[model samples]
Target: MHIGLISILSLVAVVSAWLPSDTDLFGPEPQTNATFSNLSAGKGRVVKKWLPSSGKIRGVNLGSLFVVEPWMASTEWATMGCGSSKSEFDCVMKLGQDAANAAFKAHWARWITETDFDDMASYGLNTVRIPLGYWIDESLVYDSEHFPQGGLAYLDKVVGWAAARNIYVILDLHAAPGAQVAQQPFTGQYAPTTGFYQDYQYDRAYKFLQFITNRIHSNTAYRTVGMLEVLNEPVNGQSSLVNTYYPTAFSKIRETESGLGITDNAKKLHVQFMNKLWGSGDPKSGLKDLSNTAFDNHRYLKWDTSVKVSQAGYIAASCADQVASDGDKPLIVGEWSISPADAVEQSSAFEVKSGSNSGFYTKWWAAQVIAYEKQQGWVFWSWKAQLNGDYRWSYKDAVEKGIIPKDPGQAYNQGVC
Candidate 1:
């Protein structure tokens, strides 16, 4: 999700046509049959198990991909100078279809490349959480869909790249069929309402989910796609609906993917569910009763008005909250960032220097985050930022500048998964 004008992989070489450069990690060409031997155990539940307290995953999110956040590409949006656009759909439509298509093409090509993925692996991150809007698949987009058409192909390329490097992918449905959370452009709904809670939208979203499950589970190159979140951060009070959706989605996915030769019941792809913005561990939380499910909570410090502590105090508070909320449950901190309270309203130029709150604060914060997340696992809000100066939000810049430790041991505690 893009906030105002603010926010937002890979190694090449195993991919034959990915890049003009000759630095492929997998080999001269990508492996035809990829295997997760070291990471997979007893039907691949080992990988899913790696998500909880038993094993740990340190990772980063691939944000602003299928969904674009205006602030990430503020400069591009500034060219149009459209006033107060709501979502990417509005922004693109404002630009006119032809111009929007061309601009998106350039932005997509440059925003992320094979070299980026290579950098992530080198940074020691074991998992990459990729955010995707529901319309990525053409059938889901319907008549109003006007963006360039290779969305799924681009996703396949990224997943394939991750597989070659032995990194896992958490394919997150950031935007559901009808804007699960319509406030942001990330949800792909240009209108005022998310529309996802309605019966019509819910049915469309359910079918879309089924389509996604069948496609990925059937693809060999996507063996590294370890988890598929039903939706990212649905609005509050939809818990009962979300709860119903989860079991139905799980059953649909399970039935569709059952042909993959799975014998052990525990070893299957993880279907992650959020609490749907319900209070932490609420009795009505959708995730409470789902099987083969994982809990995902997005934790943020800067957004909490009550976060008046110093870096140390903030760490203690955050760690305590996470510990309490996720005691022995299979969970992941699906979204987090290194942003500090003191620098909350600053510009990217002013914010990037000294690593958000100076070197000592940033390093200490990163260490604490890694340590806290060891109970289960965590994914930073983003791997990179559109504004290079905004290193506080970008794992790539943080690691490169040494504000955050680049040691693989810190980023990857769960071995290969």
Candidate 2:
């Protein structure tokens, strides 16, 4: 579920000594008029809200250096030919570290902070999914037993920054040790794998989650770091990979970290599992084990050219049905993009594109999303990136065309929502 939705459902209102309004990192001036509404009255209560319907579920994936090393370019690393060779892989790793440090020194350390949080808050987005790479804690480096000090320090800053603004953060481990996205870091793609379902890979991933859960759950400051994405885009073409690996890994996470102050519901983890298992139909029986966990899924409806518009209803129904089977665990569409061809097809059965129809698909899909605010919430993929041409798809264009408000500071002020 969108972190905002979770926050709302678990809403708690607090009247603490008001701190100075957080600064804006990159956008216009802050909105002094913005006020916090206490959903509950209590001392030191944490305020949470169901995702807001102020506007479209406009959110972005803060990627690259924040999640992966900017210097670790897929093309550049591939050219280095570091496959399976210890010496070459070491060199690549060093380069990646150097790149991460340099990027942090250059802008990442400054641009991503309370100000950026303020920018996002003003932008009408109620949630931000921060993608994380396993290496940040030094766990992925060959032979390293301890997490990295510098990495944890940087993330701590991120948590404090987001919390001050009342913006919910989803700590997404985008690149696990096996490099959940093989072409990306952490997967040791420089070192190839047998495929996504490797046993050792699942073990390594579980350890990573355990480490992260332990660290985050222990810290009250990071209580706002809602939902841990087991993996990003796992069921793409590798449905078998997730089908084989997710259940086992998910079960281990619950057994290891159940009842931590992290969630209110006990069956949260089970709900997450059944939601992931819903579509295949192999598990015909509904999820017998339910919990407080929400089902996380990503949809790039436009990416699969073969999927027809007529299929949109079925897709939505199937997803909703899966979540409902698990006592209606919150369903969050962690990622999605808009495209015209798909829009045309789904319009008959679902909401059609509107306005100029130029970017009407995005608007239509967003409307459909907003319509479901009470049922579930979503976080769109991506915020800003220097590698616009390669990594960013529609996001880059959307930002430029005013689809995504560029002047982040003025977003909430526009009153469009």
Candidate 3:
């Protein structure tokens, strides 16, 4: 598809006023009336009762924040001259311990602000999936000096912010001690030998989860954090290891919470595990013995090279087939976007410059609403993107341009759908 660079850059002018600078986005006063103290003991879930007609996990991923990917945020890692770096860990190492810490200290504050959380609630998103790596934990056997301190504190700040806005948080461990997937910077892997299949890596990952669970249990505000995902996109062949780790971590987390005297049944957190390659297999088959668990699947229509159909046709076909296979599983579309992949040709349906264009927007919108109704809920791939023409993938721009409904509840019937 042809990208209209002029049209995309002009949007920067429209959003510049709302974007966070050295000045706070919330201004002198906060926008949310909700407080953590009054936050219901009932944490969000994907099961039957938890499912709202609006959609369960109706949210978007806070990508390129905790997990630094070069393409998404090149300036953040630019200090290391990491333009061509393979992973976040490698980028940090290249920057050296001291420089890396200094860069992150500045970035952690600016990358995302409290106002962003307020905006999420204002626009219809009810949840956020924050992806973080194992290195953030002080107890993990990693290069502590390289990673800046107060990582958990930052996380707590986000939880509190979400709680104040009455939004749910899903603490996703995007990158484990060793990488879980290859050819992806989010995995935080530099060496080929480091991966989930290794016993030592698995052990450290489990410990990190245990530590995180304890931290959440201790925080009153963080009770808004309703779900804890074990891992993200393990290599396809490692399904057996992932299957084994799911129950082990699930039981361990429950055992840890019980030991801490946190017995609120409503706040019972669901442990989420992704099926091989984003719901390629039956989640029930893999998680038969586990309870209080849910399945996560990423539905990126553009990425499926096997399907060479029009955008609307592909979306309809995929949604119909996947919805049928979902059956009774508590499934969540953890990541999805309307952006076409790479340099390949995009469907003529989405050639328009503005996300508000009906031909491009309606098809994607209908598919998502249909998917949410069929399964538990869905979280879009990203909350924002750079001044690229792919406005559909950028939630902020989409909402601003009236492409996506400000109230996600209204998204079901915004127009042509």
Candidate 4:
């Protein structure tokens, strides 16, 4: 639970030699590889190809694990003296560093275990998208920052367990130094003003990216961590963030790979970026100058207010979605689940649709899997909810109830879509 300030800050010192100055424009070299043999595919601008073996990545997200969102673990949030706090930053502030660290230590210890990974393998899931806060490298976190320490150790356990089960890990930077957007607990804090665009915040996030990219490639414990999602759901309107930040991140990751002698096309981690943004732009345009990356697409019909509420409507929407990216890059549905409610726009996403009629959820799940296989693949929004026992959001619950098949690849209601 203590900070390893020295080791964490060393990441900056190392990457500083290759990092581009803030004023300089950054982009990728022209991609030469036609098709990345096995891992992920990126077109246009890329270094080494890291295409998937199965073409599609069948996975689930380890939600509310490293970055604790209170609603998902309400009981632990309250018992750990975090009931009043929405984000881990606030929770640490309220509980004081020591108590919060103890709570998180225990929470992370059991949130998901080796048994969970075994279950995933049994269910035929091959990947886990883990959401981590920047504070995982506690040194970059300012003294004023209030996130708990010692997340990296827990992450080590996770990847080790995952690798044993032949499951890959997609390390996602879910939270940044300053919240990427204002008032979002998932970003690690909720505040009226967003500060991720500031110079210092951008630098910290960059350092963390360098740190993780290096760790993924260097550590034997992280052998199964084949993907590094650069950032998760960053604010959409920042042009500089999309243009400069992304290219720089891509460059830094390649630099890390080079430093570690990871020149092979197959051994590299697939750097993932959002396929599209709300206002700014997408990877195709922003990252036009780079490759050796994958695009992330998060789909949800509940908040869309675009898809109909009826059962057939959900199936149609799933079948109609374009899982394939506009460019040649692999498209990953990083976060998605069954949105059963009508016209409700909540990121908390309580889709407890499977009651007695497993028929409905079974059919819908198949429709999505069938459709998503067109591109790289999809990872469900979550593995399980710790407290609520909501079947829709819990892959374990759904699997047990026969809502989602034990063998996820086998679509129960095949051709139903």
Candidate 5:
């Protein structure tokens, strides 16, 4: 999800020494009698419902943790001397594998912890959308391919914590093998040459999917992980997604689960695809048959430069976003923000400053929440990031600033909408 800019979190106490390795993932599982109240999205549906009975998925993204964005580090990336670098690829290349791994490993360790999960639970938030790079599974990367390894241990620990807090997680493949998009660091690399469409890349991606899917279904620590977003923002090479990738991934994931002796549709993982092919054509254009799936659409009004609408018009826009939910599968707004359009930011009448006392942001937030709930749910772009006071992409800052209410369930702007 592109923002006015780019991610981090805070308030996590040191977790006890428990890291899940390949050996640890399946062994005497950590004694967590976690009641997965949130991860259980629903049961007895061919096309599942990812929303709760009472409300939508009031959630935030751990966007920058696994997929690093240099510009928006919660702590300044420049101070780390990697500021000039555009993405993790540049950082790993510049710092070399070992040095870059140390920096990133440390960042991943401290940026988020159980305390952050507790904080999210306190707000009654139901889900977390975790964006991760394809490189997390080391086997896929070759000698020449430079990507940090040993990330699965951290992922295992984080999802276990989420389970304890009764929060669900959507493990998203943010960056596929050849950098699905040119979005730096976020895509795990600064891939100027988009090669995800190549046959070799698809094979690697399928392997990655099998690896991750098996992990989530088989690992008790990952009980909180409910959805596997097959890909994130596939703006390039769109035809393959519907005609080939989506169908194949659906079969591969289902087959993997079935092989694990999981046959009931209820116990299976829900795969999420882009609500529509982004920079390509319609999602339904050549969509094949798939089951146990949902859709994800990201709406960032911040980039609209055409015409600035009034605050009331913003509510109208949120209320009017029915097209995002037009698909047969359930929809979730994977990313959105309270940030106004570029034109609105420049408007003298709106006074659109980040975390401004202008009730504009609050109303906009509520409007989208109410509207998004009408379909399935929504997850705000990010939980924490570098922008000091701007709540545009930072859900943490928004909640702290009172622009977004601590209890998201309260429809503060429901009357207006």
Candidate 6:
């Protein structure tokens, strides 16, 4: 959709103000009113609430939802290849420009809007996490004239579509500058150390979070945008790295956006301290962490053919306990993907394959896990990704006839109160 002339002009003016230098999108003012509020004792568990008449998650089951990265939603998009070249910034800039344009087109927009969400809602999904790139917000970049209007307008449309169907949208900042996942898509590089802890990149990330929190909280339509994921799969190689930065960033965001109240005060502080303590690896730091915020963790079992899933249950339980010990705060399995084989083996200690037991195994295992941990909510690994040939990870297949049965798009509408 074409952006309104007024918005386009306004964005152009903003862009001109920061052409030569990347100005701070989040101004220097200290947001003071933002403070954490503690949850009452015994009320720390993930409670089931029904969706309000406005079609939002109020009280409901912590079920899986199909997630799609709309910023990467393009027919021509490919895995990270440009970063391997010498001039990484040039390559990234070129790719980013192309991606931005392609994402704006109606073709990509309609594909994600029509196919992904509609089909996911039909597949017993209560929520859909849409991972947007930090660059999408023109206000953050301050150099792109087309960004503020185009990106914001497109996202506005996305939120409107989901709200109409009562589908909860989790706004995930997947492609943070520091490469939250430490690899392609975010940094356009593969296992590179140079991009790991760049100060400027981290600064950019902090700014992006502020921009997103401000933008979403400002729009009433996005109240359905339940949570803001600080970072996606922040590598555990060194806990100190994130621990030192996360709290600082979290404080900045909370101060900037008062609407995103510190819902679970104790839990939030605890997680932040845990992140720092874990990063620092200093047990005797004598840091007492607070609690009351939702903690995000991603898990893929050993059998998933990527990371060993054996530790999946352990990681989940451990994180839960951490939150509980500090205070009672909700834990969200921000991302996970386990086939029938992995799920069955984990749940009932039975090995299964994807072919013969595809249907039974998938359904049984998914239900088993969801039932196993009724408190902590989860959003499945992905709805789609850059893949080749026939792949189980393809949401296209799940939407068609793979994981979903009957009308996949309407499956989420069932049992959604």
Task: Give the candidate number with the greatest TM-score.
Answer: 4
Q: Rank the candidates by lDDT, best first.
A: 4, 5, 3, 1, 2, 6
User: Which lDDT values do the candidates have, in the order given?
Assistant: 0.60, 0.46, 0.63, 0.71, 0.69, 0.42
lDDT tens per residue, model 6, 177-289: 64555435443233345343556777877787777666554554453455565665455565544555566566666665444443433212212222221233322232233
TM-scores for all candidates: the values are 0.77, 0.61, 0.80, 0.84, 0.83, 0.59
Better of 5 and 6 by lDDT: 5
- For candidate 1, the TM-score is 0.77
lDDT assessment of candidate 1: 0.60
Candidates ranked by TM-score: 4, 5, 3, 1, 2, 6
Looking at model 5, residue 413 earns an lDDT score of 38
Which of the numbered candidates is closest to the native, going by highest lDDT? 4
Candidate 4 residue-wise lDDT, 29-117, digit = tens: 22333233222212221222222232357889999999887776788677777878878888999889998889998989888989999
Q: What's each prediction's clash count? A: 12, 20, 0, 10, 0, 35
Could you tell me which 10 consecutive residues in candidate 5 have the lowest summed lDDT?
1-10
Residue pairs of candidate 3 with colliding backbone atoms? none
Q: What tens-digit string does per-residue lDDT give for candidate 5 at 1-417?
A: 111100111112111111111112122232344221212322321222222233357789997888888766846566545667888777778888888777877877888888899888777687889998888878788677776656777888888798777577888989998887765568888878676876788888888888888777655666657688888887754677677777777778878877776765656777888876244444555546555677788877666443247677677787666636356356788888876765556566455463343576777788888878776677888888877566677888777777777788676534647
Clashing pairs in 5: none
The regions of model 2 sitting more than 4 angstroms off are 1-43, 46-58, 69-91, 94-100, 103-107, 144-149, 184-196, 235-248, 255-288, 307-328, 339-375, 387-400, 405-417
TM-score of 5: 0.83
RMSD (CA, Å), each prediction: 8.8, 10.1, 10.9, 8.0, 9.0, 11.8
TM-score-wise, the better of 1 and 2 is 1
Cα lDDT tens digits, model 2, 309-364, are: 44344344323432234444456666654443434543543332333433333333
Ranking 2 against 5 by lDDT, winner: 5
Model 6 residue 357 CA deviation (Å) reads 3.8
For candidate 4, the per-residue lDDT at 221 reads 57
